[model samples]
Target: MDDTSNQEAYDRIARIAQEVFDMPVVLITFMDGHRQWFKSHLGTDRRENTPDQSFCRVPIATGKTTVVENALGDDRFCGLNDVVDGPGLRFYAGAPLMTHDGFAVGTLCLFDIKQRSFAPEQVRMLEDLAALVMIQVKSDRDIGRVDPLTRLPNRIQFLLSLQDMVRADPGRTCWIVLVDVIDNRNANDVIGALGIDFYNEQVRHAATILKRHLPGNTVYHVGGAYLAFMLDGAQDTPHALIEQLDTDLREPLVTSRGIPSALNPCFGIRSAGLMEMSSPDVLRTVLSAAREARLSERLFATYNSDHDDAQKRMYSLLSDLPEALRSQKQLYLVYQPRIDVASRRCIAAEALLRWNHPIWGPVSPAELFPLVDKTGLIHEVTDWVMRNVLRQIAAWKAAGIDLTVSFNISSKNLFEDDLVSRLSEVLDATGVDPKRLEIEVVEDMNLDNSHIAFSRLSAIRDLGITVAIDDFGSGYSNLAYLLSLPATTLKIDRSLVAQALTDHNAAVTVPTVIKLGHDLGYHMVAEGVELPETFEQLRQWGCDEVQGYLFGRPMEPKAFESWLAASNKALLASA
Candidate 1:
C-alpha cells in the first residue's frame, strides 16, 4: 500500500486496541535521528515519549515488538524498569513501526496495569497503528517547516537557511526585525470574550500581508503579539523594513461584516555589526526594543540602555496594577458636572477616573487609563466606580437632590453579554432607581458592529437610565456608526470645545455638531467649556447641555452636595 493509506491502518489499530484491551493510551512512534518521536497518540498524551536511553530503544534497534506484563520482574526490562515501577504505570506493550522501504522505525504501543493477558485483536491493532505512524512521518519529512498561523516558513527553516548562507560566507550580516501589537489587553477588553481570537487573526492577517511584501524571509510568533523577521543581505535597510512593516500592519483589518478595527504595531530593528551579537541575541534585542518602543508610545525605538529603565518601570507598573486595584493603592474616582444648557443648571455628573499614586500624587488619565487598560483592570475599576457612584447617588437622594450621575464605560463593559444584567443586579443590590443613573460610552465603542453592545445599551436605556456618547470628535467621523448607536446624548469632546471661542474650525464644529445632533433628535452636551464664552457659544449653537470648569470643577461628593444645597437655598431666597 501507498504511504497515504497508513492513516486508515492507524485508525483501524486504534479501534481494535480500544475494543480489545479497553485501554485509552495508544501511540505509534518512528525512530528518527536520536529520538523515537510519535506520529500519533490516541487517548494518550500527545508526543509523550521515553528517552532513547531507555528500554524502548532495543525494540526499534532490533526491528521487533516487545510486551512486558510487569517490568519490575521481567528480566529483559528489569535493569532499567523504574519508569514502569514508577507511579501510574504497570503493564507495557510495543510494536515496531515499519517504513514502506521495510525499515523498522519505532513502535505502536499500549500501556496498562492490573497484569492482563494480551488479546489477538489488540496485537493486530498495535501493528496497524505502527504502520500508520510510519506513513505520517514520511509525509511530514517531505514538507518544509511552515507556521501553523500564516503557513509561512517558520524560524526553524529560516535558521537552517541562514546556516547555509553562513557556510557560503562566514562574514554574512543579518538583520532581525521584531513587530509587536501594542495594548492587547485593551484590544481584548474592547473585543470582549472573543478578543484573543480576534487578536490572533489580526496577527495572522498582518503576517500574511507582510510576507507578500517581504523578500525571502520567515516570520515567527516568538511570544504573544510578537513576530520576528530575519532578513538576509542588504536589500532592505532597517528603517525601510520598519516603514514597510508599519504600513502593512497599520492597515485596518475589517471583519467580513465590514466593521473596521485598528491594530497599532511597534517595530524594532537590530542589524549585525553593532555589538557583534549572535542571531539569537539579535532577535532578543530587537524584541526588547520593540517592547520598549511600545512602552514609550512611539512608532519604534532602537535598543539602548536607557530604554531598559523605562521597560523595567512599565512592566513594574503593569505587574502591580492588579494588586493595586484589588487593594487601596491606586484606584479611585472623580465626579464632573453635566449642566443643562438652557438654564445653565447642573442636572447630572459624569464620573472621571483618578489614580492616587502613592508617590506621584496624581497620575493623569492619559497615563493611568492606558495602564489600567493594559492590565485588564478596566472592569475592576469600572465596577468600583459603579458601586461607589450608586452609594454616593443614594446619599445625594437622601439629601433632597434628585440629580443623575453618569460614569464612562469601557467598550468591554458595553458588549459584556452580562453587562446590563450585571448592572441590573447591582441596582437591585443598591436599590438605586436605574432611571436616575446615566451611562456614557466612548464615541468609538468599536463593538465590531455586534448588536450585543447596541442591545445592551438599549436595555440600559430601557431601564429609564440615560446614555450618552462620551468624548465625541476624539474618534474618526463614522456618521452611520453614530446614528446606529443607542445613545440619547452626544457630548462634544474637550478638544473641540476648548477651541470653540477662538478657532474658526472649532466654532464651525460646535454648531455643526449641535445641528447634526438636533437633526438626529438627540441631545447635545459640550465638554470642556472652561471659559464662560465657550459655554455661551454652546448654548447659542442650540446644544442642549454643557459640562466643564466654567460651571464648576469636579468635586468630592460631599463638596458637590454642599454646593448643590447652597445653590438651592440661594434660588429659594431669590424667589
Candidate 2:
C-alpha cells in the first residue's frame, strides 16, 4: 500500500467510485491494527483516522457491503466523530475488499454530506469494484514475491509460505535445506574474470538443476548464490536430494561463451517442528549451518546451537574490533622474548596482538585472526599492529635498550602492493632502523601465487628489512619454493616442536629441518620450546634462535623491559 504504483491504482479506483456513485467523498481504506489508513481519498485531505472514526471499518468487520442511508438517524453511526462534526457525512456505503481466504483486509467506500438512498444496482457495482481492487492488490503482491532472474519465488514469498504452513499445522515437522552454490570469493572471481552475465547464467543453471532434482519442491533464491527449499520430514529426506544435487552441480556449467565453471555447492539442513521456530529464525539457523559446512570443507552440515552461538560471538567481536583498535585500553601488544641459542641472551621479541574486549573479557589471536584474515579489515588490523610495534621499538631504542621486534603479517597482507611503501613510511616516521624490525610471513600461503609473493617479499627485503618464513614445517612448505623466497630466517612451527621428542617422524624431521634451514643460509628459530630437552635438542641442531614459554611468555612493553634488564643482570652475575 505504501508503493506509489499501489497508491496510484487505489486513487484511480477511488475517483471512479466517487464519479459513479455521485458521492462527495470516496475512500479506499485498510484497517491497520487500531487505525484506519486511507490508501486513497478523493475529496478528503485526511490520511488516517481511528477505526472508530471510520465508516470503512463496518464493512471490513462484517466482511460484506454496509449501507447507512442517514448517519444521524442510525444509532450505530450517529455518535461517530465524522458524522457529528463538520462536513457531517450522512450517507455512507462500503463494500469489503475481501481476500480469497474470506477475510476483509480493507474496504472501498463512498460518503455524502447530504442523505441519499443507495439503489441495489449501485451496491452491486461497489462490490464489483471492491473485487477488482482485491485482484490488483494480489497482482502487485505476486510480482513482489518472485525473483526477476530465475522466475522463482524469492525469500519474501518463502517466508510468507512458511508462516502460512506453520499456522495451518503447527505440529508438522519439516527440514529447511539451504545450498550455497559458490562462496563469495569464488563468485567474485568468476564475475570479475567473466562478467555478470556469465554469473547470472551460472545461477540460472543451478536453479534449473535444483528444480529438476527436486521435481515437486519449490526452490527459492533466498540469497545471492544461495538456493533453499523445505521438505516434509515425514514424507521426504533431504539426504538423497542433497546427494543428487551435489552430483549434478559437480558437472561444470557451460556458459553462453562455453566457459565451464563448477558450482562447488555446500548444503545446510535444519529439522524441527514448525512450532519450535519462527520462519526467519529457522532460515538464519540453516544459514549458519551452511557457513559451517563451507568453513569445515564438508558437503553438508546440520545446525548446531553451540557453533551458531560461537559464530555470533565471533561476528560481535569482529564488529567491535575496529573501535577497540582506536581505544587506548582495549587493544595492546605483548612481546615474547626471542633468545639467541649461542649466547642464550634475549636478542629480539615477537609482538603478539591481544584484545581485552569490554564484553567478551579477553579475545585470543587464534580466534580473532582467522576471522580477520577473511575480510579487507585485515589490512587495517595489520597496519595498526605495525604502527604500534614500530612506536614501541622507537621507545625501546630511545631508552638505550638494544632489542629487535618482529610482527606477523597475513598471507593477504604480504602480497599487498603498497606494503613496502607503507612500512618505509612508518619506519621513517618513527626514526626506527629497518634492521630492528622483522616481518613474519606464514609458510602456508598459497604457493600457486608464489611468484607474486616472492616479488613482494623481495621488494620489502630491498628496504633492508628482514623477512622470516613463519610456521615452517607446517602448511605447504616446498623446499624449492622456500629457497627462492627473499627471507633471512625460518621459524619452525610449534606443532613439530611439541611432538618432536614423542613422535619418531617429528624427532627426525625436526633436526633435518633445522639443518636444511641453516644450509639454505637462513637463520633457524624454534617456537614452542617448552621442555628443557626440546631447547637442548634445537641448540644441538644449531638452531640460531628459540622463542617459547621456556624463556618468557608474551609481556607488555614495561614488563618486557624489566624482564630484559633482569636477564642481562643475571648474565653479568653468571659471568
Candidate 3:
C-alpha cells in the first residue's frame, strides 16, 4: 500500500472508472505478488492480466458483484471463444474490487458490447463509484476508514457493522442511533441561494430516512454532520427507528425561499452488550452515547475513543478543500475598515474572507463560507474573490488608498448570466475602478424569488459594481421587498444595528429603515458600529455609512496600510 499510496489509489481508480462508467474502458488489475499488473487503463486492453487465466478470477469467485449479461449465455465465457466470440464480448458489469481489509482484491468491472440495461441510477453510480475506490484505498492505507463526505460508511463503518452484529447475535442488545445537522450554517444562510440544494437534499433526505425506517444491517454517513445506524437487534426497534428518522429529516423542504428550512437533528442512543466492548469499543459507546445526546440538542458534537480527532481533524480539513481551491491553497484576503461617517476616514474596505489554514488556524467567513457555498466551491471561491478584489483595488490605487473596497458578493453570485459579463472581465482585467469596486449582497435572497431577485440585482447594477443590501433587516421579506432592488446601498443590519439604542421599537425601526432608505434613492449604511452612541446614532439618522468593530477590526494588508496611516492622523486631529 505504498508506492506513493499505490500510485494514489491507482489514480483514484482510473479517475472514477472514466467518470462513472461513460466508460471508454478502464482497468486496475493488481493481483501482483505474482502476476496481474495494469494499475489503470481506459478503453482497450494494452494486455497484462495473464498468470493463469485472470479476468480477475470472476471477481475472486463471486464473493459478490459480477455481472456479464450476454457474454453469450456466460458458460465461464464459453472457453473464451476468441475473447467472447470474435470481439463481441456483449454487455457487462462487475463489482468485487474490494480491499480495505475484506479483500476480494480486484475488479471494478465494466465493459460493454452495447446490449444495454444499466439504470438503477446506473447501478448506484457503479456502486458509488466502487465506494469511491474503496475510499481511496482506505485513505491511502492509513485507514481513517471512510466518510470523506458521503463516500458513506465510517467510524470504520460503525466498527465493521458492529463486528458483524456481534459475530451474528452472540446475545442481542445492539442499538446505536446517532443523527446530525443543526445550524447547518445558519439554516444555510436563511434559505437563499437554494441553501446548497437544500443541504444536499437534506443529506440525501437523511440517508433516505435511514434506509426507509431502519431495520438496518448498518447505515453510516459519519463525517461532520453524523448519521450512523445499527439498530435491528429489535426490541421496540431502536426507539421506533429513532422516531422515524427524527420525523423524516425534520420535514420542511419546499423552496423558492419562503424560508421553511427543516432538519434539526441530534440523537444518541446506545446499548451494546455481547460481552461489553470491542466493535471499536461498541462504536465508541454509541459515539459516547451520541455525545450525551448532543448535550440535549445544543447543535451536535459527539464522539468517543476519547475526543481528540476533532471530527477526524474536520474530516482531514474537509478533504483538502478541493486541493485548497485547486492549489491556490488556503486562499487569502482581509480588509474590513469601512468608516466614512461624514469622513471619519477609512472610506471603504469590507472584503474580509480568510482561510490561510495550511494547518487550521484562521478559517472563518463563518467556517469556509458554507464550505464554499456547499462545494460548488462558490464559483471558484467567487473567482478567487473577484480576482483578488480586483487586485486589491489595483493595490489600493498604487498606494493612494482612495478607498472604496467592499466585496462580499453571494446571492449565489447573481445567478451568473455572465454576471455582468464576468464583472466586466474583472474590471477589464484589474485596472480596478468599477467605481472602486463595492459589491456586498448577502441579505440571503429569494425574497419569494422576487423576480429572481430583481434579475440578479439588475445584472449587478450593470457591473458598475457598488451594489450593497447585505443583511439589511435580516431578510424574511426584507422590508416588504425593498423596491425590487437595483441596490445602490442599504446595509442597515447588524440585527438592526445591535438594536438601536436599546430598542424603543428598535429606535423606531432604525429611523424607519433610514427614512425608507432615504425615500428610495437608497444609501443608508449603518452596519455594526460598536458604540459612540452607535456612531452618533448613525450620524443622526441620515446614515450614509458606518461599518463595525467600531470602525476597525478586519485588518491586515500590512494592518490595512497601518490603519490607513493612523486613519489619516485621526482625521486631521478631528478637524
Candidate 4:
C-alpha cells in the first residue's frame, strides 16, 4: 500500500462494498503520503482528495473503524466542509486497512446522500472486506520477498529484518549462523545410488531440523547448499546452541530411499555490534566468512579478526595467482637435494614451489600449492613451474652449477595432451637438455582415463623427460595399472618410509617393494630418511635414491646453488 495504486482491484472491492452496505456511495481510498487517492468509487468519479477532505483519513489515523452514522450531527466529523454542504454526505462507516504490524494505511468506507444508521451485520461485513484488502496489500508486497522453495522470508526479507533490528537497537549486536553441507559435490553419488527426489527430501529434512531446533529462528536458503538464520538481542546467547547444532548435525540422514547419506555440515557464525556496516554488507561478509570456514577442514568456525586477515590473504593470493603464473612475479622454485643410497652421492633434487607475496612475505609451498587445485588453475601453475624449472636449469648450466631437477605435475596437467608439447616447447626454447628434467605424478591422482594419461606421459618420456610415480602407497592405486603406467621412477611416500622404522610388516613391505622396482628396472626413491635405522634399512634394501632431512632440506635457489658447489657428491649438480 506504500506505492500501490491498483484502481481496478479497489473498484471491484468498492462494487462489493456498495452491494454489501446498500449505501449510495462506496469508496476505497489509500492514504498516499500527505494526500488521499481514491482507488475506487461508486458515486464519484474523482481520483484524488486532500487529507482534510478525506473521510478515509480519520479511520487510518485512529487505527479503528469510524462509524459516523450522522456526520453533520457529530461534532468530530462536522469540521469537514464536504460533510456540511458539498454532496451533503451525512452517513459514513469506514474500516481501517491495517498492516501486519497494526499500522492502518488506508480505509474502506461507505457513504450516503442522507444520514443513515447501519446494522451490526453490515459493520462486520465492512470489517471483513477491510481485512481482505490488507491481505491483498501484504500478498502483493511479499511476492519477491518470500522464498519459493522453503516458504520463508528470503535473503531480501532477512536484510530488511536486519535493518529493523539495527534501527530498533542501534547499540546491540546481531548474529547470523550459516549451515553448509560440504558434500553437495558428491550429492550426485547419492542421486545415482537412490534417486534425484531424495536430494530434495534431504533439503526439506535439513530445513525441518533447523526449524525444530531454533523455533523462532527465520531459516533462509541463501543459495548453493547453504542455510542461514539470524539471532538478535543481548540476552540470546547463540554460541552454545551453535555448538550443539554442529554436533547433532553429524548424524547421517536417511533418505526417502531408506539409504543413509553422510552430511558434512560446516557452521560459520558472524556477529556485529555497534553498527559498522549496513544490513546487506553485513550479510555478505557473514556469508563470505561462512564460505571460508566451509573451505577449512574444521566442522565449525567463527569469523574473527584473524580469519579476516587470512581471508584477505587467501583472496589476494587467488586473485594474483593467474598473473603470477603468467609473469612469474614474486614466485620462484626451491630444490631439496636427494642422495644415492649406494654411491652416497647426490642424484637429483625435487623442484618445490615458493612464493614471496609482496605484502605477506615468504609463503610456503605447503600453504600455497593447494591454491592451484582449489582454483582449477593447476594446468597454468604446472606450466609456470616447468617453464621456470627448465629456464633455471639452462641458467644453472651457464653458471657451471648444473642440476637435474624433478618437478611435480598435477594429474590434471598429465591428462592434458598439450602438456607434453608445452614441456617440449620450454625445453627447446630454453635449449636445456631434456634428460636433466623429470616430471613426478602422485599415485593417488585420479587416473580414470589411464590410457590417455599414460599416452601423454609416454610422449613426455620419449622426449627424454623421465616420469616418477610420487607418494607411492600413500593412497591406493591399482597394481596392474601402476605397472602399465609409463613411469621409470617410483618415490615411496614419506609416511610409508616413517612406518618402516617401527613396524615389522612395514619393514618387510619396504624391501619387497624395492625388489619389485628393481626387477621392473625402475629406480626407487625412499623419502623421509630421518633416522639412522631408516637410512641403514633403505641402503640394505638397495633403494636407488633417498630424499629427506638426512641429506638436505629444501633450500632457497642461492643456498642450493652454494650447496651444490660445496657438496663432495656433486654428480647431480655438475653432471
Q: Which candidate has the highest lDDT of all?
A: 2
TM match of model 2 to true structure = 0.81
Runs of candidate 4 exceeding 4 Å displacement: 1-160, 181-185, 191-197, 208-217, 236-271, 276-312, 326-329, 398-402, 448-452, 475-481, 498-506, 530-536, 556-558, 568-575
TM-score head-to-head 1 vs 2, winner: 2
Candidate whose TM-score is highest: 2
lDDT score, residue 172, model 1?
73
Query: lDDT tens string, model 4, 276-308?
Result: 335366665666666676677666667776767
Worst 10 residues of 2 by lDDT: 1-10
Residues forming the 10-long window of minimal summed lDDT in candidate 4: 1-10
Rank order (by lDDT, best first) = 2, 4, 1, 3
Lowest lDDT sum, 10 consecutive residues, model 1, at 273-282
Compose the digit string of candidate 2's lDDT tens values, residues 155-219. 89888878888888888888889999888767877888888888888788999998987888899
The global C-alpha lDDT for each of the candidates, from Candidate 1 onward, is 0.71, 0.87, 0.68, 0.78
Would you estimate the TM-scores of all the predictions?
Answer: 0.57, 0.81, 0.29, 0.65
Model 2 global lDDT (CA atoms, 0 to 1) = 0.87
Position 179, candidate 2: lDDT:
92
